[model samples]
Structure formats: structure tokens, C-alpha cells
Target chain A: MKALRYLALSIAAVLFLVPFYLVVRNGLVSEAEISAASWTFLPSSVRWENFAELFSDPAVPLVRSMVNSLVVAVLQTLGQLLLCSLAGYGLARIPYRYSGVMFYFVVATLMIPAAVTFVPTFVVVSTLGWVSDLRGLVIPGLFSGFTAFLFRQYFLNFPRELEEAARIDGLGHWGTFWRVVVPNSRGFFAALGVIAFVTSWNQFLWPLVIAQDQESWTVQVALSTFLTAQSINVHELFLAAAVSITPLVIVFVAMQRWLVRGVAETGIKE
Target chain B: MSHARAFWLFVGPFAAGLLVFVYVPIGWSVLLSFFDARNTVTPVEFVGLRNYADMLTDGPFLRSLGTFSVFAAFIVPLTFVLALVLALLVSQISFMQAFFRSVFFLPTACSYVVASLVWKLSVFNGLRSGLANTVLSWFGADPVAWTVSTSPPWYWLVLVTLRLWLQLGFYMILFIAGLQRIPPVLYEAAALDGARSWQAFRFVTLPQLRTTSVAVLLLLLIGAYQAFDEFYNVLGTDRGYPPFARPPLIYLYYTALGSGGQDFGHGSAGAVILTVLIVGVTLLQGRVVRR
Candidate 1:
């Protein structure tokens, strides 16, 4: 029975590992080796030069897209963290008359489907002459109601004594937030940051529409241009995908503990 | 500062961003749906209900919805079953649990676009050299035209497998969380009665996971309706995607932006319709699931 369990698990594990294997193995081989009408489960020889070719290909510079993705990801993450945390703190902590109404409104916005906003958001961006620009790609997504809701939920459980202590020390709302609340909430902040960064970095459709210019394309958008029937080469495409997802894979492996917690906190509530 | 002043100061940035980006666009979408708009928001003609009427009558848009319905039907159940099985299996194991959990979830971290492309041109590529075809070769089967063959929809095998591979891990974790919340004592009680494995699962595990299963199923249904990235990334070309591969979102995008012409009026109407479907289904499902 124990052996049977292990065998079942091993089968499941192998099924899951196929894609990872294809990415790593096929990525390291040449185009001829991949398209030879025979399955090569293992690479004959590691040809790391496919990635070099991908990077140096003037059509879609993998390096430029990575940097572009980094800029968007970092700015958007920082922006959401700052903005959502402020709103969440205000809605959660401040003794304002309208906080309850405001909190309800903010959380209610979370239910609005992304499809409704897709076109009009584009209209607004194009009207603002933000087409093919970083502002167009990054700004519209800088604040999310769901992220703010997570922060609000977290802050509600935060110890009130910290705020009172800050008040005793002559700290105002902003001061209390910066000095006391933030100092103790590094785990939540890291979770939010990692989640926000991964999301922004991996965003495909929004970037695909907004960043059509080669100079402005995010990594996923750049990787997508290779899928056009003419340019579709499995070897380079796999290498590019392997390259594009490497950072996220690294981030996931490193902070998966917190990432899982963040996903749970957001998902189970819904 | 006073309460009102501090409140505004704290919430000002988020409120400004949300109003300008989120609220205004949504409000504008409603108004845009009424007019004969094009690439620009400047409505070319005042055509109230015509845009809506046109889409309602359009065969392609309706077909796209049907296609998406099939996708949703297949995906929601497939993911629910697969995620639950993996979760149940993982939950029982004690060794290297976190390692296995992360391995399953690692794909969820992968971008959908990347995953889809990898599945299409690499694994399920129509060529005999493709992984799926190569695997079949050993079974004395032939290479399959996956994306191109809409007659029997070999593309569905591509779509469903990629979607499952991409999404199963995340939902599995949710199920695991749900599974853990089922206290061990219930199982002990079941064991006390000498209940068999199937009986224990049926009595103890199934009933306890009701809320999580509903949440999982509901989320999967909603997500299936929003399908675009995979279909577009995998099946689409520089010109356009095949009819069979088009979901409502992809269909609407092409209607709005395809070189045929940018018909934001019709597109926004479709968007409005899609939004209504999402909200209505969510409300209906939430009521059902919660009750």
C-alpha cells in the first residue's frame, strides 16, 4: 500500500515535470535537434548559445524587455504598496466619520470585473497620449482595490496599542504609520511586494495592447511576438520562455512560504 | 490635523488613482456602448441600442460565447477534480510535503502566455516532431493537427491540458488549506467506527470541504469566462486566431481592434454584455454556494 502511494505520487510528479523538462532540455538544444521528428528526452550537447541568439536578435531583444519589465514591475509594486497601504491604514485605523462608508466602497470595487474596464481604460490612456509609453502601461494598474482590501484586513488585526504608544510619543497619523506600524509589519509588506511584483512582471494582455512599440514591450509581450507563424522556432522560443520566467521562478522558490500565505489570504476570503 | 483632513490626506492618492483609472473608465464604457464609436472615443454616430442589437444578432459573437461556455464547462470541473485529487493525495503524505506542494504551485508562478506558447509550439505543435505527437508515435498513432483541426477540436486537448497545468497548482493549495481545516478528530471518529477509506472520505472529507469546493468551483467558472491570454498566445497569428480558438474577450478584441475596423461601439457593447454575465453568474453562484 505504501509502495502504491509512492508510485502514484511519482506518476503525478512526472506528469507535472514534463513541461519543466521540455523547457530546460529543449531550451539547451539546437532547432534541428528539436524538430527532427524524434523525441530527444535528453540534450545531446548543451547549446547555451540559443539564449545568446535570443538576446542578440535585433527583432526582440530579450535584455531590453527584461529591463522594461523590471522598471514596470518595480514602479508598479512600489506604487501599489504606498497607495494601498495609505488607503488601507486610513480606512482601518483613523477615527474618521466616513471611514466605514469609504471602506465599504473600496472593498465593493473589488467585485468589478476587469473586462468592463478593459476598453474604456484604453480609450482614456490613448486620449491622454500614453500609447506606447510606460505611463500607459504602468499607471492604470498602480492601485488595486483587492490589494488595498488585503492591507485593510491586515491592519484591522494590528495591535491598537502601537498606535496609542505612538500618540504618547507625539506621532501623528503619518508618523505613527511610518514609525510604528511599518516597522512591525515587514512580513505582510514583503508578501504584498512579492505578489505585486510577480503580477506586474507577468501581465501579458495589458502590456500587449499598450506597449506595441518594440522599445516599450514587457518580457511576456516580447516573448509573444515570437509566436507569430513565420517566426515560430521552438528552440529559441523555449529558451526565451525559460529566460523570461527565471526571475519569477527564483522569487517563488525563495519566498514561496510567504507567497503561499498571501495567496491564501486573498483567495480564501473570496 | 482634524479627522476629515487626515482622512483625505491618507486616502487621497488611492482615491484619485481609482477614480481616474477605474471608476471613470467603467462609467465611460457604459456610455460608449450606446454610441457608434470607433478607434477613438469620439462617437461617429449616435446609435443607441443598435450596437447592442447588432452584437445580439451577430452569429460570430454568439458562437464565441458558446465556445467559451464549452471551455468553462470543461475547465471548471476538470480543474476542480484534478486540484482536489492532488490536494487529497498531498495531504495524506508526510515526507517532503512542502517540496511537493511548491513543485505543484511553481507553474502557477509561470506566466500564462509563456505556458500557452510552450504548450502549443513545443508540446502540442502540429508537426510530427512535437512532444505530443512523438509520444503518440510510440503507441503506433499519428501526428495530430492540434490547433488547426477544429473539426474534432484537437486544440481542446491543447487548451485544456495547458489550462490544467497552469492553474491546477493554485487551486490545489486552496483545497489543501480547506483540507487542513477539516480537523483530524473527525477522521479519528470515522476510524473508530472502522469506516473504510471510501466511507471515511465520503462522510468526513466530502462534507467538510463544502465551502472550499464551492469557492474553487465558483472561481474556476469565473476565470474560464475571462480566457484570452492562452488562446491568443497559443493559437493566434499575426493576422488573427482561428474561429474555434476565439473566446468572447478575444472575439471582442478583434471586433474592436482588428484591421477590419475598430468598432468600439460593438466591442464595448460586448464588453458590457460580458460584464453583466460575469456579475450575474457571480451573484447567482455566490447565493447558491453560500446557501
Candidate 2:
């Protein structure tokens, strides 16, 4: 039984990692070998220049794009965490009339498809003169209904005695939230933080719509440019893709524990 | 602070964001659907249902709706069954469960654009040099234009399969969570009663996973309706060939923001219609789940 389980898991793991392997291998191989009938798992001759070529390529601003992605990811994650936690804490802790109504309104936003909002959001961003700005990319994403919902659910399960004790000590609402509540919810925060980071990092459509300037293009947009460029360099394009995704893969590995917990919690609840 | 005051304070920022970012946009879009909005910065003139009238008479919009319905009809069931089977298989494996789970979940982490691009360039490349064609050549079969061709509907199958590959892992994880919640003793008792593996799953697992199955179905339906990136990336705005594979959202996107031209009014109508369909489907699914 144990051996069977291990075999099944091993097969699953291989299947999952095969795409990553293909991507990395394609990145390393020379352009000639890529179109060949059969290419070895390990490249016969490593093309280390592919990495440098990705940055130096005049058409695509690979380095600028990476920095743009990093900035969006960091800003969106921080803002989402703060806003979501505050709203979630209120929903979980405060007993007030119409709270349920407000909560439902938040949940309703989750159902609104991005396609429905895309053009109008474009209008809003354009009107605000934020069309090619990093602020446009990060600010809208900073507050997510899904994140608020997740945090609310997590906070609902948190113990209330600490907040009560803080209150008894004459701690104000803000003081209680910062000194008492925030400290106790580290795990929940971490879990939500990883999710927020991943979502912001992998975001494509809004960023694509808003960031018209190449200087502010995210990595995904930059990679798309490579794919769609007038002169398509398959080797360089694959290498750029591999490079762009490397950070995300690393982050996923690092935060696998928190991600798993978040997924499991959300799945079970839903 | 009073409870009402505190609640208002707490909800203020988030509410404002949601109103501006979500509700206001939706309201504006709905309003725009009644207007004759053009690319110019000038004020939009109210045409009051002319866009909807145009949509009613529009052949391409109807075709897109029909194509999208067909895509969703095929994709939802295919994804659900694949996810359910994979979930059941992975759940029964006790050792290295986390490894399996992470492996399945990895695809979910990839953006649709990335996955679609990867499949387009490398996996489903039309030329003989493509991965799929190369693999088929070893089997003494001819190369297939997986994305380029639309005849025989095999191209649609490739698109659906790619979507399934990307989405199966997510639903599988959800199903696995649902499966884990079922008490082991129930399975053990069923086994003692001489229930076979398939029988045990049918009688025990299937009934227990009803709510999750409904949720998964609803999610899949919404996702299928909202599928723009995959279709947009794979099939460019122009229907390059005879049998076009453009989904509704793609059509909406093209109508609204395509390089050819922008017709915000018609596009808004399309979006509104699509949103209503999705919401209706979701609500019906929710009712079914509750029952």
C-alpha cells in the first residue's frame, strides 16, 4: 500500500514538473537544437548567452519589466494585507447593524468578471491620467474583495479573549487592532500575503490594458512582446519566459506551506 | 466609538474602493450600453437601447454567443470529470500526498496568458517542428494544425484540452479537500460490507461531495463564460479561417477595445448580457447546491 502510494505521488510530481523542465530545457538549448526532431534533456551545448541576450535585447525592456512586476507585487501585497485585515477584523469583531449587508456587497464583487469591468476600468484609469503609470497597475489591485473575504473568514475563527482583554485595559480600537489583533494573526496574514503576492505577480489583463508604456510593462507583458515581435527569436523568447517565471517558481517553493494552508482552508469552506 | 460609527469607519475605505472600482464601473458600463460612445473624448450621446437592438441583429455577436455556449457545454463536464477522477486517485494515495497536491496545483499558479503562450509556441505549434506533430510522426501519423485549423472540430478539442490541463489541477485540489472531509470510518464500514472500490466511491464519495461538486461546476461555468485570454491569445481578433473559434468574451473584447475599432456601447451590452447569464447560472447552481 505504501509503495503504491509513493508510486502514484512520484508520477504526479513528474507530470507537474515536466512543463517546467520543458521550459528550462528549451531555454538552455541552441536555437538550432530547439526545432530538431529530438533534443536531449540536458543540452548538448549550453547557450549561456540566452540569459544575457534577454536583457540586452533592444526590443524588449526585460530588466525594467522585472522591476515593474516586483514593484506591483510588493505594493499590491502590502496594501491588500492592510485593507483586507482591517475590513475583515471589523466584520469579524464588530457587531453592528447592516454589517451583513456590507459583507454581502463585498462578496458580490467577487462574482463580477474582469471582462465586464475592463473597458470601464480603462476609462477610469485614462480619465485619471494614470494610463502608463505604475500607480494605475498597483492601486486598483491593492484592494480585493476576495482577500477581504478570506481574511474575514480567517479572523472569524480567531480567539476573542485577547481583544476583550485589550479593551478592558482601555486600549482604543486602533490600539487593540495593532497591539493585540495583528500580532496574533501572523499565520493568517502570511497565508493571505502569499496569495496576494502571487495574484499580483501573475496579473496580466489589467496591467496589459493600463501600462501602455514599455517602461512600465510587467514581465508577462514584456514576454508577450517577445512572442509577438516582428522578428520572433524563439530561443530568446523562451529564455525570457523562463527567466520571468523563475522568481514566481521560487516564491511558490518558499511559500508552499502557507499556500497549501490557504488553498485547503478556502476549499474546505467553499 | 458607537458601533455604527466604528462599522462605518471600518468599512469606509474598502467600501469606497469597491464602489469606485467595481460597482461604479458596472453602473457606468450599463449606462454606456445605452449610449453611442465612440473613440473621441467628446461626451457620449444616449441612443437608448440602439446598441441592444444592434446586438439583436448582429450576426457575429450571435455567432460568438453560440460558439461560447458550445465551448462551455463541452469544457465544464470534461473538466469536472477529469478533476473528480484525479482527485479520487490522488486522495487514495496516502504517502507523498502533499507532493501530489502541489504538483496538481502548480498549473493554477501560471497565468492563462503564460500557459496559452507555452502551449501555442512549443506544444501545439502548427509546423512539423511542433511537439505534438513530432510525437505524432513517431506514430506514423501526419502533422495536425492544432490551433490553425477549425475543420473536424479537433482544433476546438485541443483548445478545450489545454483549458482542462490548466483548470483540472485547481478543481482537483478543491475535490481533494472535500474528499478529505469525509470520515474514514464511513469508508471502512463500506469496505467491511463487501463494497468494492467503485461501489464505495459511488455510494459514499459521490453523495458526500455533492456541495463541492456544485461549487466546482459553478466555478467552471463562470470561468468558461469569462474565458477571454485563452481565446484571444490562441485565436487572434480576426477569424483567420472559415470556422471561427472566438468565444463571447473575445468578441466583446474585440468590439470594445480591438485595434480595428472601439464600439463601447455594443461591447457594454455584450458584457452586460454575459454577466447576467453567468450570474443567473451561478444563482441556479447555488440553489441546486443548497437543495
Candidate 3:
């Protein structure tokens, strides 16, 4: 029985790790080595120059896309932090007559498929001439219903003592929020930030449409163009994909627990 | 300021984004289904459901839906079974539980784009050097065209395997989380009642996981509908794609945004149809699960 269990795990682990090993191994080698009809498990030589080549390649603009990805990811994460936290504060704490309706409206956004909104949003953004601009990629995605819902749930269960003590000290709503709630919720912010940053960094379809120019292309968009445009550079493509996911893997490794817990917490109560 | 007015201050930016990005677009999509929306401007021609009528009967679009159904049919069960089995296996181990969980969950951090590249370029590459072909050669079988072959099901094999590898980890974690929430004393009591392992699992574990199963099922269905990145990266190269591998989004993409200018009306109608299908499935799942 123990052997059977071990065997199953070994198979699953091998299946999971083989592609990863291949991508990493093939990424560090020459293009010729990768495209050959047959190949070695390990390269005869390592080529750090492949990455330098990708960065220096004038046609693809790898470094610029990396910077673009960082901007989109970081900016989107910050925007969501501010907006969702504030909205969540209002909906969870401040008792307004219409807060229930407002909460429902926000929650309802989660159900709508993004495809349903793609054409009109594209038209609107194009009409505003946000095509080939960062605003088109970043602004449309800043506000997430899921993140807002997360913040709302988090704040709903928060103890009132902190807010009450702040109120007793003569602070108003905004003051209490800025001074108290934000500080207390730093861990949640970090967790959500990592997740949001990864999502924004990985965005492909929307960025593919709007980041029409080479200057504004995010990493994923640029990587896709590398594959489809004229010639396919097998090694470069593998290397670029490896490059794109490296940041996410780092963030996940460093904060895997919080990320997992955050996602699990998103589940609606039974 | 009034309390209500202050509330709006907190809600303003998010509400504005939601309106511009989601609500307005959805509203416009519904309207566009009725009119000839050839461009961003107001449609000059009011076709009165001609766009909907045309797309519904369109062979390629309808066939794309059918293809999606088959793809989902393969992936949903495959992922479900594999995830459950892995979850069960991992949860039984006392050592390195966290390590196993983290390794499995690692792929979930990778984008669908990267996953597709890994699967397509390295694993399922059409050349004899491709990993799949290399393995087949050991068995004395001819190198099969994994992505291009339409005779049998090499393309489906490529799609299904990549998707399962990418997603199985995520669902496994979710299932493990669900399983861990079930108390052990219940199983002990079942054992005392002369129940075997299989019987205990059937009555105790299965019943406990109902909510998780329903949630997982709904999420899987919706995600299967949105299978674009992997599909586009793997099979979609140029203007032409094999009919067998086309999903609804890819078909609609070409129909609406192809090089020879776009027909926005047809695209919006198709998008609306897909949205309705997703919403319908979720509602049906909710009803069934509730029962």
C-alpha cells in the first residue's frame, strides 16, 4: 500500500517537473540546439548571451516590455489597493441608506464574462484614443470586484475597538481609515498586491489588442508576437517565457501561504 | 458633509471604472446585438436582431460551440478525477505535505501563455525531437504529428494534456483544503460502525465535499468557456486555424477583428451568446447543487 502511494506521487511529480526542467534547460542554450530534430537533456554549453540577445534585440524590445509589465502590474496593484480598500471600508463600516445597493452593484460585476464587455470597451477606449497607450491597458483593469469583495469581507469581521478608539480621539471617517485601518491591514494588502501584480503582469488578450505599438507592449504581448511574427525563435521564445514567469515564481515562493489563504478566503460561506 | 455624500467619495473611482469598463460595455453589447455596429460610432443601420439571427445559424460559430463542448467534456472530467486522486494521495501523507502542496501549486503561478509555450514548443513540438515523439520512438512507433494531425485526435491530446497539467494543481489544492476541513472523528466513528475504507469515504468524504465539488464544477465550467490563451498560443498562428481546434472566442476574434476590417455586430452578438451560456450554466449548477 505504501509503495502504491509512493508510485502515484512519483508519477505526478515527474509529469509536473519534466516540462519545467525542459524549459529551463532549453532556455539557456543556443537557438540551433533547440530547433534540432533531436537534442540533449543538458546543453554542451550554457549561453547567458541568449538573454542578453533578447534584451538587445531591436525588433522585439524585450527590456522595454519588461518595464511596461512592471508599470502595469505595480500601478494596477496600487490602484486596486486604494480603491477597493476605500470602497470596502464604506460598504462594510459606514452605514448609509444606499450602501446595500452599492455593495450589490459591485458584487454583481463578478458574474459578467469579460468577453461580453470586450467589444464596447474596445470601442470606447479607441474612441478616447487610448489605443497604443498605457491608460487603455492599466485603467480598465484597476478596479476588481473580486478584490473589493475580499476587502469587504475582511473588514466586515474586523473588531470595532480600533475604529471606536480612533473616533474617541476625535478622528473623522477618513482620518480613522488612514491612520488605523490601513496600518492594521498591511498583511492583507500585501497578499492582494502580489496576486494583483501577477494577474496584471500576465494579462495578454487586452494588452494584445490595445498595446498595438512596440513601445507599449507588455511582456506577455511581446512574447506572443515573438512566436507569431515572421520567424519563430524557439530558444528565444522559451527563454522569454521563462523570463516572464520568474517574477511570479519568486513572489509565490516568498508569499505562498498568504496567496493560498487569500484565494481560499475568497470562497463564499456555505 | 452628509454621510451619504462621504460614502460616494470612497466609492467614486471604483464605481467609475466599473461603469466604464463593465456596465457600459455590457449595455452597449446588448444594444449592438440589435444594430449594425460596424465601428465605434452609433450604428447607422438598425437590423432588428439580424446580427443575432445570422450568428446563431452561422456554421463556423455554431461548430465552434460544439468543439468547445467536446473540449470541456474531456478536460472537466480529466481534471476533476486527477485533482481528486492527487489530493487524496497527498492528504494521506504525514511528511512534506506543505512541500508537496507548494510544488503542485507552483504551475498555477505560471501564466497560460507560458504554459502553452512549454507544452507546444518543448513537449508537443511537431518534430521528431519533441518529447512526445521521442517517447513514442522508444516504443518503435512512428513520430506522430501531435498538433496538426486531424485523422485521429493528436490535437485534442495536446490541448487536454497541457490544460490538465496547468490546472490540476490548483484544483488539487482546493480539494485538499476542502478535505482537510472534514473532521477525523467522523471517520473514526464510521470505522467503529464496521465500515470499510471505501464505505467510509462514500458516506463521509463524499457527502462532506458536496459544496466544494459544486464550486469546483462551476469554476471549471466557466474557465473551460474562457480557454483562450492556451488555445491561441498553441494552435492560432496566422490567419488560418484548423477548424477542429477553434473555440468560440477565437472564432469570434477572427470574425470581428480579422485583417479585412471587422464586423462588430456579429462579434457582439456572439459574445452575448457566450455570456448567456455561461450565466445559464452557473444558474443551473447553483440550482442542482442547492437541491
The residue-level lDDT of candidate 3 at A58 comes to 72
In model 3, which runs have C-alpha deviations exceeding 4 angstroms? Answer: A230-232, A267-270, B39-41
Per-residue lDDT over B188-259 for candidate 2, one digit per residue giving the tens place of the 0 to 100 score: 999999999889989999999987887787778777876766665665423332337777766766677777
For candidate 3 chain A, the 10 contiguous residues with the lowest summed lDDT are A261-270
Please, what is the TM-score per model? 0.96, 0.93, 0.95
Please give the distance, in angstroms, between residue A235's alpha carbon in candidate 1 and its true position after superposition.
Answer: 2.0
Candidate 1, residue B60: Cα displacement in angstroms equals: 1.7
The A-chain TM-scores of all the candidates are 0.94, 0.91, 0.92
Q: What's the interface RMS deviation of candidate 2?
A: 2.7
| lDDT string, candidate 1, A61-167, tens digits | 78998999999999999999999999999988888888888887687666665654577788778889998999998899986998888888899999999899999
Q: How many backbone clashes does candidate 2 have?
A: 0
Residues A119-169 of candidate 2: C-alpha lDDT, one tens digit per residue: 777766677788889878987776688778888887787788888899999
TM-score of model 3's chain A: 0.92
Q: Which pairs clash in the backbone of model 2?
A: none
Q: List the residue pairs that clash in candidate 1.
A: none
**Largest TM-score belongs to which candidate?**
1
How well is each residue in B171-275 modelled by candidate 1, as lDDT tens digits? 998999898899999999999999999999999999999888887887787788878888888788877677666888889878886768888888888888887
